[model samples]
Target chain A: MNQKLFFTTNILILTTIAFVSIISDIGAKNYTYKQVNASDPWARATSKLAKTGAVYIKNIHNKGKNAVKITGFSANIAKKVQLHNTVVKNEVAKMQHIEFLEIGPNKSVQFNPGGLHIMLMGLKRPLEKNSHFPLIIKFEKLGNLEIMVDIKNIGWSQKKPSNYKHVHH
Target chain B: MKKIIYSILIILVFSALSFGVFFISDHYAQKWQSNKLFKAKLYDVNGKTWSIKSLKDKLGIIYFGYTFCPDACPTALNNLTIALEKIDSKKLQFEPIFISVDPNRDKPKIIKDYLSSFDTIILGLTGTDRDLKSFTFNIGATYSLSREDPEDENYLVNHTVGFFMITSKGASLPIPYRNNPEDLARAIEQIKSIQMSNSKFKKISSIF
Candidate 1:
């Protein structure tokens, strides 16, 4: 009976240790970063003399408990990468610099034309369509995510209205 | 049945009254916003003096932006270029004018170089701070300059994003156009309609 009791105690202690280790492994993971899904990354092509352009991405945070903040961005094509928001007030469109963009858990943030975007300043060369470039996005919690931005033509986001008809004189 | 009829009657009367009020207010608002042309002297890319009165006989599309603008101005200008290319210039005498809000950075040479990337026909104009203020304010356009350092060459100027259509009579039509082919086409149609009506009115008056 004594030997049996000792055997039972050892098994119980081993099981507890295994369970705790599993829990700790999950807890140590970078949960906030794992939940961030970025897609549809694109940049507008600039002219030869143009030194700046913008990049857009659709960021979706899957985690429902914590918000993810985009802290910084880096691209080889530009000398400076800054997060910007286009604010339209009283018919005037103003581009304002933002420190970070926070997306709530289970929410999405679309960076598109006439809205929030990543400004790429001092471009080394003009962005050409069908060409891709690497963009590293740093997050407050998720760390850094490397994304490939597809270069598109100017006014790529503008779609003709369905009711539009050609005007002829 | 009588109560329901009374409620229906009251709602109808209120709806009509509200529609009438909105229509009248909109009419006055449009009148207040239109037909006011401010005169200013601006320098073109060729260093020629371009007065506001010079645009009187032509249908003008005035755009307020800077040369250093990365996305918005270039995209807008490109769209204008495409739209102008589509239209027959002989049918409608329209001109696209790009006015620089950042006069400090957008000099004549800079404007000329910047505009060369887009349509060469686009007339690039710039003016002094005093000249821009009088012109922009009268046209209901606004822009702000943000400089982190006083001497920093890398600064941002946030200005209005769209284009304003000026009628041949030099009156602003109050409707702004986005950098889209459809919007430009629509504005052209409206201008043609106005031109037609004005010519008809002139003919009738001449007959009298």
Candidate 2:
């Protein structure tokens, strides 16, 4: 009888974990996570001297019928990760922290450099090229979705200045 | 009554025309004022006094930003480095100068450490309040820093995006910041050609 109870309790916990409705950092102790369908999610490689970094995602679409709110984000690499949007007025750039980001159904949001970005503060160490770190994106109703952000080479989004004729020594 | 109303309407139209003229002239004045900033004294992080005048015949690119800026500054610097590298012609002498508007937190040592992330050699400069004001005002670059308290270490600074490409004659062309490295490289070449023609014209005039 005890064995049966134990088996049922383990099944319930598994079900809860599988749903992934629990909060980040406490629930879903396992490393297994569902992938967030995002496009070109990457962070720029940083020098060792840098204490802050920025992350970019080309597009994040809300497939659900209802609107979803990205309440917060957590990263293991940085001390803090905040949603930030840069507004340029009369050539002046101002970065503002967003309390939360909402995505309407069938709509997409872009996180790009010099615009919407994920600002990583108090970086524990420099982010290297081709490396990746796990980022937990918390949603109000969708729960926590974990995504791996790859660190691309600096200026990867930009084109080469010109075809190298080797004039620049 | 008719005469008085006509005079008032005439006066209103004259005042409106003058206001429009002033606005147009003021905008052009700021663009032309960069030549005067060529003489502005810039104190580099190395405790060296430098000026656009000292750069002489080279194209000088000036960017005003703080070391603590996270998104725009780094991306601008990276893109600039690429553009410079692509335009690496021995005939086209160019120098990239980064001016720190937030000198309170961005000391010489801090600025040095921050600039090391890029591949190119950039001269990091900061100045006293008076000196900075003269240069920034003449160039029309604006910046503001907000702090919770005077002792607040983590503060955000809002600054103008883009770098001013100063030609050999001190005439500046403002290039807005974006992901277009090709545009930057092309602009640099265009400036070089214009400078070349100006020099050629100068030499011919001297012969006369």
Candidate 3:
């Protein structure tokens, strides 16, 4: 009886560890977003006719540990994928190479156009107007989630209509 | 015989004066004219004519290239965009202007659309191919075209990368010589310094 009880305890401990591991892996939120501070964010393409599409994903919400991983994502039209950041050095905007994103604890990160963005480089063809590209985002812990991004023309703003944004000279 | 000799002497004097003036002008133009970015009439992407002189107080970054450029032009533009962020808005301002060297393919609409991707302030300008070549060559600029794909109706254009920094008073500072990012930044900084100094010598004497 004693032997049987010890064996049962050992099985329970092993099962608990296995279940925790599985939960952590599957619980990772992939491409999850929420409001940063406000809904309005600056996003624009470098050209009205650029073969590329960039959007500002702001007020991102990726709480808890386990550095968020974004990979295995494919766009229907984009030939290559990259995350590009425009860092200011000596008052000049320089492109920096980035790989993954990490939002620690309650902190959030924003990917604003002309600043930091995920460049869908080398589009297989021009992204047609009125059509959206589905981005398959994968996370190490959360598995996979997909987001459909709208390709807006140059000078596009997420701000509400009837708003006149100032053009600073 | 005396009358003929006197007339010959007058003729010799005039010829010498003309030669002296011609030599000085040519030397000045060759040394200083090519570096200045002067204001001139340019066609917008909509084919409407415009000029940088319209922005009298602001400085302009004038770049010459085609919309169909595969890589360098866009990268240069991107670098310029990055470089502009470093400028202090209160002291000086830099506006980027895209001048299409290939007028055949880069129409007003195409140029406008290409420039629209960046900030709204960036202007896109183009003109007839002949006009573009004439204007570019006059500045000692060089460019060439190569077919991208014979199979396709559309083709690519390859050209030199050159940008001019023109101020409101019509003074131009040719930068990068060939579109190097470091050179661009240095040129902008130099412009900013000149503006900050509040120097009286803001206007250029020659136009290339």
Candidate 4:
């Protein structure tokens, strides 16, 4: 009877250890949003004639100890997503596509109108005012984080609408 | 023979004086000419003829952008709108205009609807493809359509991103695109100051 008890105790110990290690392993590989955060995510409402959309996030900060890289992005409303930085030289403005963006530890990157932004092409539908949608931000080291983006009223580009209610995801 | 030579000399002197006068006048012609922004042919949102010249006796503000632009156009226009709003009631009235470079996609109605979304009454205008090109080029602005085919609808337009201010007398004050409203408002004030100085100079030079 004592041998049977000892065998059972050993099996339980081994199983517990295995389960704990599996969880820790998964956590290390996929920290998800715990490593980074996107704040003040918003987009302007698109007109019916608009074929593309743009998403602006106030800042993306790497909250973790290590740097994080953003590899890809997608929106529920767009068939394709690209990172674009609008550059102005000698009064001429153009948008340049960016493939990856890295955020160092304790550092943040900003996205705004007329600057760096996520461009959504082949929009499935026009983004309406006061509407919110989901966008998946893929990380190089960490996993993807789905962020909710609020759409502002048309032409509310310079000032955040006074009635804007930020819905945190 | 002496009489003939004297007559020839007098005639030559008069001709030279007239030629010098004509050359001086030709050299200063363009300096007093009107702004190209005021002379360019464009159709307004109502399909009626429009130009910066119509804003006579008032300040003229114009910007080159497409209504379909997702990011830059709205931001710049908004900055313009806010800056215009900051101008005091005592200040002379101004007409703010938006010229669409995307003639293929941006129609009069589309531009009208787009301008309605903004706070102020921004006059939206467009023209034929060739006309648009020449208008922008002559006005010292540059723009290009991304796709070879504008019917693609998904194309983008890269344009000179900023607002141009003109005094009532047609002196141009071009301000580059900046996201700050304060900077824009300050530029607007500069335009007025420039106009003030311009009229003051004109009054003093009128005696000449």
Candidate 5:
């Protein structure tokens, strides 16, 4: 009886150890999964007369193995969407369409004003402030992920120039 | 000695003639540009015909862009608005005008709505391609539509982003103000100087 009791206690301790290790492994995996997540997806409110608007997304990839490539994107807010980069040449601004954007391992890509942005053309309706819309981002490795873009005020992402001051009389 | 003297005399005469021609041509070219700007007709957001004369007595910061522009147009317009607000418009009459390059999409109503988002004082203008061409040519502005299907609504327009300062007399000032608050302030100072010179000229003419 004494031997049986000792055997039973050893089994219980081993089981507890195995369970704890498994739990920790799962936690680590989840952390890795979240390392390459998208954050701060936002769009600017558009006026009724505006036919196009831009969407910005911050893509972060923390993994050191595979580089994440954003292949395409889609949204119900517009008839068509494309990736575009604003190029300022000779102080003249022009938009250049790009095929795909790649975020290398342990790197991040920011889609912001005066830089890479998702151009939504032929907007079905004006994007109002405080509203949200669905955007599906397709990736080369991770497949597709649906994100909700928060619509903010027009020029929300614009940083006021340091010397800029509004003088109102 | 006689031959050398003749050659020297001929050279001097040619030099004087070239200088005279250059001076006259430069003067007339400047006059023509200003006259063309005054005569060029454009349609305001109200669909009413307006000319550069309509903007007289006010310093105008004119820019040409499309409504669909995402970054540059808004940045430029916003900077202009901020600059305008910083100055005392009552003392120095300053007007901001946004001319649309995409006239097909930017109707008078559309442009009016777009400008309202920036500032109420801003005047939005749109016109046919021909009208725009003449006005832009006179003002030394350039814009081109991207190559896309005629029916495609996703086209882009490449345009010059420099703000053309139009003096009160409907002439494009030679000073180039890239869309910034500091440059705009500088432009304002230059405008004031021009105004002073004009007033002095008027006073002299009155004396005459």
Candidate 6:
């Protein structure tokens, strides 16, 4: 083989290897979750006809190095935005706040009742039953995702928080 | 045969007297529970009115504190939650309501946000001073504001540390739970037993 042709072939092989490795990494760094409707997201599970006052964002698994960024919460229904969790100690019910939702590579995040859920504080109007609300959830790497959450009936007795284990009484 | 009949009569009289004494004591105890309650109206985060009356037919566990309270409020609330855990769920139906004595600092949104940290069912109530004083006095709960520090806007509030477990009909549920896990568990067991007895009586009456 000519000397010039040999050098060119070596450079071509290196470039191809680099390209394959990049593509493989991108494939391994994706996260997926089961999409959830706003109705019966967290608090709704306590009763069948719970008011879907809050939007449900479920199956929030992320496979990346950075934490997931959830923004663009402004909407007509809720006046304020917050993250909420229910923690039990000495048999008392306590509500907590979380500032960030951490998502690691090949790791997932959950926003279910009694654990971690977005609190849609200060509802501008009553959450009508069987209605749907559009929520825009943004991820740092994924950019933006849109989900529609359905409203369920309010005051259903059977639905409880996800972490609530029924007592004998 | 005459002597035997006289003895039987005496025994019957003694039984009746004992029953009367028992009934009177029980009635007095129940009345005491009702008289021990304090009055206060609670407001939700949205400034909606929340009264203890609405939770009738259920047990009410109420605590008075502010969101800006440094330590006592959170610690007491946590302790109450722990006590609830020691209770048998079947025996008691209760709700924990948090009333902010400091309405100026603890707004509806602030109370709601701060209360989100616990794992229990807590309702934050805040209202006008007159309303708070009357409610506190009626419920037998005492609260006062501490001096504010210029360094921080969050001030401290000194208040009572206890919960009232009331029945669905606005009567006392007779909760003798203490801070200890074992004692709390025992008290809860007794409460459940009492509820069960009452329910059994109801069922028997219905059948008759």
- Cα lDDT for residue B67, candidate 4: 74
Q: Which stretches of candidate 1 lie over 4 Å from their true place?
A: A1-33, A58-65, A128-130, A158-169, B1-39, B52-57, B78-91, B119-121, B167-169, B177-184, B191-208
Query: How much does each candidate deviate from the true structure in C-alpha RMSD?
Result: 15.9, 13.2, 14.7, 11.7, 10.9, 14.5
- lDDT of each candidate versus the true structure: 0.72, 0.74, 0.56, 0.77, 0.73, 0.54
Candidate 3 lDDT at B166 equals: 64
List-wise, what DockQ does each model earn? Answer: 0.23, 0.40, 0.13, 0.38, 0.36, 0.02
TM-score of 4: 0.75
- Candidate 1 lDDT, B1-208, residue by residue in tens: 9999999999999998897676667555544444334346689998998765667666777889987676567767877777777774452567789999999878898788777656437888988888787777767787889887999776899787767766544455434555466687676667657765865654454432
Point out the higher-scoring one by DockQ: 1 or 4. Answer: 4
Q: Which candidate has the highest DockQ of all?
A: 2
Model 6 chain A weakest 10-residue run by lDDT: A43-52
The segments of candidate 5 whose C-alpha lies over 4 angstroms from its true place after superposition are: A1-34, A58-63, A159-169, B1-24, B88-92, B174-208
The per-residue C-alpha lDDT of model 5 at residue B75 equals 65
Candidate 2 achieves a global lDDT of: 0.74
**Candidate 4 segments whose C-alpha is farther than 4 A from its true place:** A1-32, A154-169, B1-39, B88-92, B148-152, B167-170, B199-208
Cα lDDT tens digits, model 1, A1-169, are 9999999999999999999989964342222347777766778776566678888764434465787787889999989999887766666777788887777777666665666778898888888877889988898866898887878766465343233332111
Q: Write the per-residue lDDT of candidate 6 for residues A28-59, one digit (tens) a residue.
A: 22223332112223222111111113444444
Chain A TM-scores, candidates in order: 0.70, 0.71, 0.58, 0.73, 0.70, 0.54
Worst 10 residues of 5 chain A by lDDT: A160-169
lDDT of 5 by residue, B1-208 (tens): 9999999999999998897676667556766777876666678888898777776577677889988886668767776776676775453577788999889788888888887776437788877898788778888788889857988767799887777777655556544645566677677667667866865654444432
By TM-score: ranked, best first: 4, 5, 2, 1, 3, 6
Model 4 Cα lDDT, one tens digit per residue, B74-98: 8788788788878843435778889
A-chain TM-score in candidate 2? Answer: 0.71
Off by over 4 Å in 6: A1-52, A63-67, A87-95, A155-169, B1-34, B38-192, B195-208
